[model samples]
Target: MNSLSAANTHFTFDLFQQFKTSKKDDNIFCSPLSISSALAMTYLGAKENTAFEMEMVGALHFNEVTENTEGRTTRDHVEKLGNVHHQFQKLLTELKKPTDANELNIANKLYGEKNYQFLQTSFLYYVESVDFKNAPEESRKKINSWVESQTHEKIKDLLPKNSLEFTTVLVLVNAIYFKGQWDNKFDKRNTVEKEFWLNKDTSKPVQMMKQVNVFKFTSLEDIKAKILEIPYKGKDLSMVLLLPDDVDGLQKLEDQLTAEKLREWTSSQNMHDNYVDLYLPRFKVEETYDLKDTLRALGMVDVFNPQRANLSGMTGTKDLLVSKVIHKSFVEVTEEGTEAASSTAVVVNVGSPPTHPFHCDHPFLFFIRHNKTNSILFLGRVSSP
Candidate 1:
């Protein structure tokens, strides 16, 4: 699971760079965990060139493999498939364990056309038969409703009215909802309006929440930045904020951000428990992304190409190809804690905090990490908030 978490972490950095470059100066947020889970669901049915392409898609899917999944496959192909689904199942199972401190719900479900013969193997998500051919609209509603319910209604209308086509074969959906109270909660009375700098000269008034506490802190002397971790109740998860010493240093920080750098900077050995002044703005960010273009730009071209896709493991034929992937995420940080949920649906588609006088007055990077598993459930940027 740690390897999978690391792989997902690597993917998160790669994806952050893509969004950062494309949506320059705008707030960016997405769940690599959700996206990876959905893709892994789709990968269960991929074979031959498609399987090979996905497996080596720059650490896209793990090598655990899934043998004996539904549908008929050559002995060699089955051997190639292994236990990737089991890995995801394990991940889902582990993350789904009940926790009293946070309202966390994560679910993955595969909705497929009623007639396709699904390849049976380890089930990482609930597999449902839908009438995409006869009732695409109703099917879309059903999927959206399920996603909404899974995320405590935080994520709604995940699949728009026209999202599903009658010809759509398989759609994988992953939704993660988390509401955690800060361990050292801030007092609402301390929140006040303050200037939030979008840039050195440009700024806007924001409701800034202030607090003083001891936290895992580190100073990036080389990059002129500081990192702080504010744990949520139960201490199993923490929100980490990386603030640049210079008011306008986010770009340089982002340009230098990588999995290795993040690991080194946030490692326990580098961070120390220290008392510091902390100020974070009360903010909420919701963004939707049509990841088809992004994924293709990242060299995942063949899966979207019907002519090139070889997902024979699905129905034992090279007929299925991913059409579009849509992801919608919402997050709100207030005095109590944070409320965040993200839904990633494959049309086949398919955090942080501060301390240390660590005032997030300017654009910065943040992520919500599940401390025990070291899995980053969410990664985002607060450009304006």
Candidate 2:
């Protein structure tokens, strides 16, 4: 019998827990299986395999237009979705080997490979930025543009189109670029605003951004958390933010997380009216990760066990070990709601705006939530966003 190490289990447990809590807080549901798949690919020595998941997802969102009304029947489109799901499952099922030699060899092959079009062809576009380790601005901008185009311009509108659509997006665009500002920025001109608390005793005249619109919101004493859902312009996408009342409540929520808890929290939320005296900073970031080694470091080894595992359905032979896992995700938050997009397919574009000032100032967990299911498509945090 084979098993994950204590440290590895702890890592897995922590990642799952964090994902659950954060997803719950954000009112978004991401497929745990997908995360597991990504993690497992890493464990099987398929360092690039994890990135494949991120980039593919990002690409899906990048080009995710309202399901087109073209001649393709919804049934046919569903079949395509089913085929993708089946292929993904096949990849996961094949990488379950338990031998060290098999696992290590697969890892070497995955890391050594250059042409990862298999992943791209599977609907994943990849991208990355090579910081001069000096982190030159020109290099950084070049890298940013590459990521933007790889995601099919569903991202960074500021980049030069030519310079932006480089191969880097094919590898790193879904890695995670986040930018946010408060829904209610503090104006130097009008610094005098009154603030109010739900409890009158705690009330101070605060600068509340007067807003008018419906929002998905909820308060849970059982969980000690407040959840808010902000929809994107397309309405297909949204940002769900969860704020734990106790500054330390996040850890507790993480520990108490479960599928049931998640379902409960999301279902309990309702549309409501809200007000806020919000002050938040505008912050920008870009993070690229090579999850190949990380997943290998985890405990998934079958899919990448090229020799032992079987994936004949994909490539006709057992030689196809997942070569790389690249992820790039980007988000921009402002007073006009939230806009974000991720790419995991060969190419795609995906995003939004807001009213009032929904300042996500406090320690809050957010998610890039899709409307269809309770599954968190993407999970994140705004410890400072």
Candidate 3:
């Protein structure tokens, strides 16, 4: 497969710029890997921008994961991710975008006939010319098991619930395992039962993490926002918090969010010396979503348009179409810090932040990012401190 090249660098950057600008906050991060994936998929006849944008929006579902998942294992999370990807792909395939007569017919046939049905199952399938039918049954089963285990079995069956004859095929499988502890470990003694501010005049009883420390943070008047950087145990990951000055000023921060502005704000974060008392709730969130509709809304109309897509690289016949896209994420928050895992993919990756003594004490938007690439792996908001 061809790699993402410099030829489309500006176009790709522009796409991301538009994506960041459209968001109410700088919540989207794309990794080079994601970019390459989309580019290669597109080169094979997939809609590149649609795939990339869908991945970005797919990240949003993780917010719910951070709240629902308590002690789920990494294996469980991986399967969940696969199922989510399948659904998202389904949505992409079904979207009604502008297309020519032939591509349109192909789109309907590809999705209508359930050619991509393998997506909903556990056996991850790609439309490259290769045969695994004769490759040891044990090998095929192992590949399926690994994909299931890594995605936490969120994806159950892979090779379709039914048998259908397919010609060309390609498959790549990998898994990610993550486990981490809270930074300020909530003191069982200090974990007093208190009311959390859910909205003005509305509160709910919750066990919040309490701490006193110097937190690396910044207050941006220009955007009426505050930023706090919370480091993970390994220091390989950190959460960047964005808090609106006004309790309900999330809109203001959203309006100012942009790729350039986010880059500037993060780059300019300064270490500080000050005492801060923090009270944060302990919560676990988990979420799963089918990303077909979201991708359609992001201007990726062609990939799903079977009649228009030219994935001749994957299938000599213009009969293959992306059928679904699904994503799932998990996160747990407590006094010590947060542990989060997102499965699915994006084109931007956030590199690790510079380590400085900091504590999360208030409401903020935090993003998990890879340190080297400065790409955002995940982005979330804690509404209460």
Candidate 4:
């Protein structure tokens, strides 16, 4: 369980980097946890395929299991990622449970063709039966409808036209929705038109929300950036923002960020409470991604390649291969709160304002963190907003 957060964190950053490399100047957003959850369902079903399992685990950021305690490093140890089935289940429950303080919903399901014959999963997994062979169109609509309802219709047309052909046998879908109200909610009247720098030479006007409150803040002397934590109503979750000191310094900060380095930078000890002047722009980003290329680039090739793919663990046989992984996520940041794809808790008090100045008037990185587990649910960069 302890390593589960690490896994999610690692994968989150890994996927972020992949997106960063290509969509350098664009607004970026995705829920690595949601994608990991969907992929893990298939990983759990992989049986007797040590190589493929190792690839899946490694690409997913799964750490060393019990078998690798000493100096041992083999495919099997990676494959037998100690009690992973239990950990996956626990991760889902931990993310979705104790929801009163937070509005969070995570829905994961596996749909298989009814007429296709395959082995059952090891962990009493539930694979929803659908007539993909006979009614691919209806199955597609049905799957989309289920996901739409699961996410309160925030996500629609998840499976677009012709995505599910008659030959399609299996599909995995994961949807997450989160609503967070700032503990120290910003005043709407304070929001004013401000300049947001996209780059050294480019800038745009934005509705910047200003709030003077005591917030968790810290300065990175080496990187010349600041980190601030804005808790939602319950404080179980927070929006952790990283702002570069220079208008064009965002790229440098992002380059320096890694899973381990971020832990050190944002550790509880590093951040101190002080009166902060926070200026965040009101923005919303809804992105849909086909992650087959990204996953393959991260060393997960076999799962999508039908000829050499192996997911015997998911079923009793090796007849299943993922056809497509479509991820659509939405996040909106306003003065009142946030409606994003993520969750968490914390206690914050309203008090005096003004000492520290942490302005987000330029491209910045923000993460919605589950403070209890310190797991990041949704991470994105607002390059233009």
Give the worst 10-residue stretch by lDDT in candidate 3: 101-110
Per-residue CA lDDT of model 2 for 53-91, tens digit only, reads 322333121112122233232334334333334433443
Compose the digit string of candidate 1's lDDT tens values, residues 51-162: 7766776647454233334533325645545555655667778777778778777677878787977667543235688899999999999999998888889888988779
lDDT of 2 at 324: 38
lDDT of candidate 2 at residue 194, scale 0 to 100: 44
CA lDDT scores, all candidates in order: 0.79, 0.39, 0.42, 0.79
lDDT of candidate 3 over 1-385, digit per residue (tens)? 0011221222334434444455433334322223323333333232234333333343222112221133243234334344334333432343223222101101101112223323332222442223333443433444446546654553334333222223213333222223444343445566677775545565667786565555566668777777766565544456666766565566567557654566677673453534445555676644333334544554545555656644443444455555444333445666545443322221212443343322233344556544434545445555543
Off by over 4 Å in 4: 48-57, 63-82, 122-124, 340-354
Candidates sorted on lDDT, descending: 4, 1, 3, 2
Tell me how many clashing residue pairs each candidate has. Answer: 19, 78, 75, 13
- Kindly report which residue stretches of model 3 are placed more than 4 angstroms away from their true locations once superposed: 1-148, 152-177, 182-184, 268-274, 339-364, 382-385
* Higher-lDDT candidate of 2 and 4: 4
Assess every candidate by TM-score. Answer: 0.89, 0.48, 0.56, 0.89
After the best TM-score superposition of candidate 2, give how far the Cα of residue 298 lies from its true spot, in angstroms.
6.6
Error of 1 at 182 (Å): 0.5
Sum up the clashes in candidate 4: 13
Error of 1 at 381 (Å): 0.3
Q: Tens digit of lDDT per residue, candidate 4, span 45-151?
A: 65444345433446786544322334244356334543555566766787677655568887778888887555643434557889998999999999999989988
